[model samples]
Every structure is written in C-alpha cells, then in structure tokens.
Target chain A: MRDHLAFRLAYRGTAFKGFQFQKNVVTIQAKVEEAFARYFKESRRVHFGSRTDAGVHAYDHFVYFPKAFELYTALGVSKRKSFLSSLNFMLGNDIRIWEFGRLSSNFNVMEDIVSKSYSYFILSSPVEDPILTEYFHWIRHSLNLRAMRKAQRQILGTHNFACFAKSSGVSVRNSERGTTRRIYKASIVSRLHPQMKIGQILEFKFEGSGFLRHMVRNMVGTLVQVGEGKGTNIKSILRSGSRLEAGPNLPANSLFLTGTKIRAGLYAPLRPQTE
Target chain B: MRDHLAFRLAYRGTAFKGFQFQKNVVTIQAKVEEAFARYFKESRRVHFGSRTDAGVHAYDHFVYFPKAFELYTALGVSKRKSFLSSLNFMLGNDIRIWEFGRLSSNFNVMEDIVSKSYSYFILSSPVEDPILTEYFHWIRHSLNLRAMRKAQRQILGTHNFACFAKSSGVSVRNSERGTTRRIYKASIVSRLHPQMKIGQILEFKFEGSGFLRHMVRNMVGTLVQVGEGKGTNIKSILRSGSRLEAGPNLPANSLFLTGTKIRAGLYAPLRPQTE
Candidate 1:
C-alpha cells in the first residue's frame, strides 16, 4: 500500500548551492535527506510539490515521502512519524521543515496543488536598499507603479506559459515542455517594510493552477522592464508564447512562493479578493 | 621622497581562506597584487582600511596602491582606473571600490576614524518572519526594549571596552586589554518591514569612536535576553562594568555599519532640523 507524507520547507539559498539535490555539492535536499537517512536504514526517496532553483527560497514547499520514518526511537509505527520533527531540529537553521502531515497514497504534491501563488518583489528607492538586497530586486531608478499595474492586467488569464518558464530551473528538459496555466489572480501591491527607512516598494502577486519553468520570474522581469518604459506591446509579448520576447530574467532574490496549490480538504476555496 | 600609489583590491572570501595575507592560503591582498603584477610588470602591495573576517561580506572595500600608474594603453591603465566603478559589478556586487584618493602617508583606516558604527539585525516574529529570515537573526521571543535601553546607556561613556569583545575577535592576552570607546549615540530601534505581516522588530543602532571585539554583538545578545525577560537583574546587568554579566551574542546578520565617522572632507553635515 502506498502512503504519503506532506511537508512544508523554507530555506536560505545564499549559502546553499541550490535546492535540487546534488551528489557532490551541499544542497537543501541533500541536507534534509542526509538527516532523514540517519533515521532509516534504507534510503527513501522524497517527491516534492515544487522545485526551486539555486538562490531561490520557498515559504512553502510540499513533499510526499513513503510512510516516512528515517529518524526515530523504536516505539510503534506512530512514533516513527513524530521523528520527523526531531529530525528537523537537528537539521539546523539554514534548512527548516516547519509542518508535516500524512497525505493520501494518491496525493501528489505537484498534481494535487490547486494553485501556486508567487510574489515578485520590486524595491523602489533613490539609493540601493540594503535590507531587500537579498529578498527583492532593487531598482535605483524611479518605478512607475501605475505603469507596472497597467501592464500587469494583460498577463492574467488562461495562456500558454512557455514564454515565462523558458529558463526551466535545474531540470531544463521539463521546463522546455511548456505549460498551460490559468491565472486566477494578478496585481501590483505597494507597502512600506516596517524595518526599513526611506521605504518605497511595488510587489506583484499572482496565482495560477500551475506554472511553467521560470514563468513567474519572466513575467515580473518583463513587467519591470515595462514599468521602466523599456518594453513595447506587452500584450503581444504575452501572446507570443516565446521566451525570447519576454526579455531578461531578473534576480531570484526578489521572487518568493508565498503559498501553494492545495487540494480541497482543509482550506476554504480562495476566490479572487475583488470578486 | 615616498610617492603614494592608490590601489583597488578585490577578493572572494570563500576562494581565499581568510582576509589577511598569509603564506599558505589565498588572500584578497594576494589576488589584487597578482592582478597588479600583470598590469604593471612589477610587484605591488596594497593596504586596507579594515580587515574583514573569513566569511564576512563587503559591498565597498578600499585599498591604497603605493604609486599611481597609467599602465600601457593597450594593456589598459586609464580603463582599469576608471574600472574602479566596475568594482560594483558581479561578485563585486558584494565588494566594491568607489573612489581613489591620495591621502597623507600617516592616514590609517583603524587609527584615524572619527567614529565607527555597526547595526545588529534581529527578525522578531510570531511565526518566524520569512521576509527577514536571510538578512538578520530570527528572534522568536519578544525583546525588552526598556531593559535594552538601560543597558545601552551604561556603555556610552569612554571606558575600556575590552570586556565587551571576545578572545577570538580582539585576540588579546587579557580580555580587558583593548581600546576605550566613546559612544556618540545608542538607541533601540524597531520598524515594520514592508512585507513582514507580523512581528515586533527593533534595530539597535550605535555610533562610537571605535568598537571592541564583538562588543556590539555581545551587547545586542544581552539586550535580547533582557528584552525576552529571560535574564533578570536588569539594573545590575546594565551598571555592572564586567562583560561576564552581558547577554549572549546574537547572530551577526542583525548588525550593520549604517554610517561611518566621516572626515572633514567627506562630511557635509546637514543643518539642524527647524523646529
């Protein structure tokens, strides 16, 4: 019988080589799996709901393990599951596993997720913002939020997301396949970070049933170009479905996955805020 | 007669074992000298304003080359000097050289400073703040600002700060053998980060003629304990002249050098705010 384990992960990518597991290099997966391996005699594979690239951090990353129990005292079958928490504690600060639960055998993190929401942070300031240097893309030039929002609307809806995901993270082949996604929400948000001074910012949050490779990064990067008044015909760029037309890929520091696509079990159905 | 040649130095800490030039490990100074050897066809030496630790990062680092040069045009002298601006480029993002100036041979970064300041950051949140995670330490518990302020005041006067530094940081036979510092100002500051939804945060800022080894970190760590009510005897903790009673060292992420003591030439002091 197949059993599933769900997990939530967050990591800091500056010191890590990347999120994807590498045999020789120190990576998020390797670190986590190394701890898990110590608990179990046999190595168990972990399937992830999403994959983030080098230097990309995740607020939520779901993974399903097969009735996982790598680290534990020989209590009963039940105590094995509890060991995950203990394992997390030993894993240290750079990589963390905050929440865990059992998933149905058929539950697939990638397929079952109802929607994935991503945040593209753009920091607007006359001087380079020190705090956001790692969290958001800092643009020293003035940003026209109005223009960014105006261009944002053209991107929301059902479309071939191949143009955005062309960078394809680590698994280049999968990203090249392209994707069909429905954008449930999209908008530009502004706020002042509590810890910052001389603060001004613009954030792009979008939700979709699924995303293509690097899709969020490209969309935000293009929008930033559009915000800077550098790109022309963003609507055509969205429709072109070609990665080249989207322009350059921005830094991963400013991109964040705020939430994940969850199957309807615990969370209420999230509709568009305005609607 | 001695001629001062200004040199720009750049090095990756991880690439080298440490910052200081050593015979065994690669150092930033060694690399810069290598580059100079290629350019000048002669060996050159560089001097730094401060020596950063092994893992530390520097966005702007200035080094002086004893003699100025317009290396062969084809080999590129003017371009390389102007390339000083290029220091902010690439891995240089973490290291840079803004400008070069001929200073009196007597000038020194350590001895000639008017005042030196650094900030220590802490991410205080109900649920760990994902936004502030990378750049600062995560303090899950609440901090006692009142107690912290009281403790901060005790360190303001020009007193021997040796007790504040650690053996590793200052490396003295006697822990108390160090510089006496005058704290121009000390404050407990907290602000809302733009993206952080929940948390209490304060950045402790202090400006002083100089700093003891790990003094700011040790001070902030103790303040955190006081803020969280974990440590009692707040009065004695502040008034006691010994570092033994101070709090533990918070992570280095919380600290920053917001501003430096500028020389008369670099100073363009603003007029007092009109009431």
Candidate 2:
C-alpha cells in the first residue's frame, strides 16, 4: 500500500522561475523536491495542486509526495515538528511548508482539488510605489473601480474562455476538456495600500472551478482596459472565443494563488498508525 | 549667489549600496545625480538631509541642488510638470521625486532641519513572509510587545548615544559636536500586517534631533533583545557609551526614514518671479 504526505505551501515567487520543475532554472517544485530528497535520504515524486507561472506568489498551495508511508511512519508525531523545521530551513526564505498531513493513497492532488482562488493586486496611482513594486502591478493612471466592478460581473458563471487562455495549438484542441470554465465568483475592490501614503490597491479576486493558462491575467487585463475607458466588451469577447479579441496579458508578479480547497476526509492527521 | 531646488525623494533601497555616492557600487545619490545630469546636461552637486545605509528605505528624504535656480527658472511653471515627468522617467521604478520646489539661498539643509523620524518594521512570526522579504525583518520567536514598549521608554530624552553609533575612530574624538543627542519620542506599536494572515508587525518609531550612524538599528536590536527576555538594560547601555554593550545591529532593509522636517518658510514655490 502506498501512503502520501500532503502539505500546504506559501511562497514569494520573486526568485523562482515558476512552480514547476524546469531544466537549467530554479523553480519552487525543484527546490521542494531537493529538500524532500535531502530529508528522506531518497528521491520521491512530488505532485503539486496547481502550477503557477513565474513571479506569482502563493498564500496557500497544496502538494503531495508519493510512496512515503514507511519513512513517514518511522518519524512519529514528536519528530514531525523538527522535520518540518529542518525542511523549511533547507527550502530557504522564499518558500515555507506551513501545514502537512497524511493523505489517503487514493487521494490525487490534481483531481481531488474542488476549487481554487486567485488575487491580483494593482497599484492605481499617478506615482509609482517603490515598496510595492514586487507585489503590485503599478498603473500610472487612476483606475475606475466602478467600471471594473461592472465588467467583473460579466465574467461570473460558465463561459468559453478561449479569449483569455494561451493558444496551446494542438493540446487544447485534442483534450477532453475544452476552453470552457466556470467562475464561481469574480470581484474587484479598492483598498488603501498599507505601505503607501498615496494611491489605492485594486484587488481583483476570482474563485473558479479551474483556470486555463493565462486566463485570470487576461481577464484582469480586459477589466483594466474597461477601467481605463478602452471600451472592452467582455461578453462579446467571451462569445468570440478568439485569443486575439482579449486584452493584453498582465505580468505574473502581481498575481497570487490565494486558496485551494480539496474534498474533506481525504487528509488524515500525521501520526503513527497501529494496524 | 547660489539658489537651490529642493525635492522630497522616496525610494526602496534594496538595489542601492547606500544613500551616499561611492565609487563603483550603485547608491541612491549616484542614481539621483545621474538622473539630474541626464536631465540638466550638467554635473551638479546634490545635498541630502541624511545619509542612510544600504538597503535602508526612505519615504520622505530631502535633497537640494545648489545653483539650480537658473535651470529651474527657465522651465517656467508651465514646463515644470513635464520636467518632473521626464526626470521621473529617468529615475525608474525604485526611486521617485514626489515633490519639488525652490529653496531660499540662506536655507541650509543640514542646519535648518527641525527633526527626522524613522520607522523600523519587524515581522514576529514562526514562518517567514516571502512577499515582505525586502521590506521587513522576520523574527521566528514571538516578541513580547509589553516588554519592548517598557524598554522603549528608556530611549526618550537627551543622552550620549555612543553605544548605538558605529565606531568612527578619529571623527568622534576630534569633532566639536559630540555623541550627545536629544530624542523627542520613542515608541513601539503592534499592528496586523495587511498582507499576512498569520503574522503581526511591530513598528518601532523614533523622532529625534539627529541620529548617529546605525543609531536607530542598534536601538531596535537592543529593544528586540528586551522583548526576547534577554534582560537588556537600555539605561546602562546608554550610560556605558560602548558599542559592545548594545545588541546586534538590525538589518538595514527594515529601517525607513519616514519623515524629515526642515525649518518652515524656507521653501518657495517653483515659478518665474513676476518681479
């Protein structure tokens, strides 16, 4: 029987190329796997809940390591804390494993995820905010929050999102799942940036069944165009299903994978199990 | 007769070696000077109200360029806005000249200053915050706010802050102005970090006549020691006047020069005089 160790991760993605393992470049998955190999004295295949692009941050992300039943059982409850601390020490400052538990052998990180939410921050100000350069997409022109919110309503519910997705020529066409996606909620709200005396942060939040490649960023880009009085028709763009019809893709730095939810009872407390 | 153009500058000092111009390494002063030279087409000496160390941010730092009256006068009120925009384009995203005007020829940036205030941010949390990596110093152990506040009171009032200053071998011994300085206010306050769900930010604020090199950082470090139950005696450390008595110097990235108050009525609006 195979047992899996599931963990929750939070990371600042500035230094990382992306969440996935890539050749000749540093990535979050590569670092996590490296740390896991060092700790367990062996290599194990790790599964991520979602793959985030480069410079994207995560408040809560899920990952699982397969075939770890025997090794994890030996550590027991007392060693778990030290194990996590050591792993975090190895992972460095950019990534942190905040929570971990035992996953049922049947649990699949990709298929089991029920929902995912993301937040994109925009600093709408005449002057660029130096401190928020990494976290926010600075816009020199003031954003019209009301217009963006109005346009945000159009993105809610099920729709064909090919206009917002990257054109993956053959794969997307051949895949069972098309460009259609269901957005549970989409909203835009403005808040005073904590650090900056001037300017407000426009938070664009989206909760969905799943997101296509560059979907959220493209949606935000379209909404930003509406805010900028660029006359973006989100409804028409959705219907057209043409990538060229959508707004420009926003940068990944300001994007955040804020939440990921999985089916309950799939995770068990990490402890020594007596058969 | 040298007329001055004064400006309020804000910058994230992560990329800067320091505020002062040094050979080879990039500094805030060097960047600003480069921008000035690019815009004005002449090498002009710039004066800073304070010299902050590497990775130290500033929200409201003051700077002045003497003999800039002619160039500034030529660019009438109509052209000033465009000029500022052009200069900001040259300065890039990390630094900004938010406000600028003319300074009276008699107004001395060093002597005419009323007070300066600085704030240091500390993230007291078990896990490191990745997004705030450049802006805050993360401490794993929980800090005792009450203990820190009690110790902060000892920093108020005038005293020889030799313990908090960097050792300047010949300068301290021969300078007419000694290490004695008056601190107007010293306080510590806790706030919920806007970005983080887990950690609370402890802000240490100091307002004083003048600060010695590394003074604020050393003071914060000693206070952190007190919070950690290290039994730091601020009074004794101040009395000792020995740098060794103080706690470790905190990282410069967490320190910010928040305010610089110059003498009132010293600034004149940037305009071509009707006379």
The prediction achieving the highest lDDT against the true structure is 2
Q: List model 1 lDDT by residue over A72-179, tens digit each.
A: 224476655455446656566666565565566666555678888888777765334433466778765666678878888877788776677764332445543347
Q: Write the per-residue lDDT of candidate 2 for residues B53-166, one digit (tens) a residue.
A: 999999889899987867877876767657766888899878987667878898876578888999999988766777776888988778888998999999999999889998
Tens-digit lDDT string for candidate 1 (B168-231)? 3354543333445678888877865343334556778778876665677887777777677775
Model 2, range A29-133, lDDT digits (tens) per residue? 999999999988898878976889888899888888986756877886777557767888999889987667888888865577888999999988766777778
TM-score of every candidate: 0.65, 0.88
TM-score result, candidate 2:
0.88
Model 2 per-residue lDDT at B63: 92
Of the true interface contacts, each candidate retains a share of 0.00, 0.31
Task: List residue ranges in candidate 2 displaced over 4 A.
Answer: A1-3, A67-70, A76-78, A105-112, A168-177, A192-196, A268-275, B1-3, B76-79, B168-177, B191-196, B268-275
Q: Of the candidates shown, which would achieve the greatest DockQ relative to the real structure?
A: 2
Score candidate 2 by lDDT.
0.83
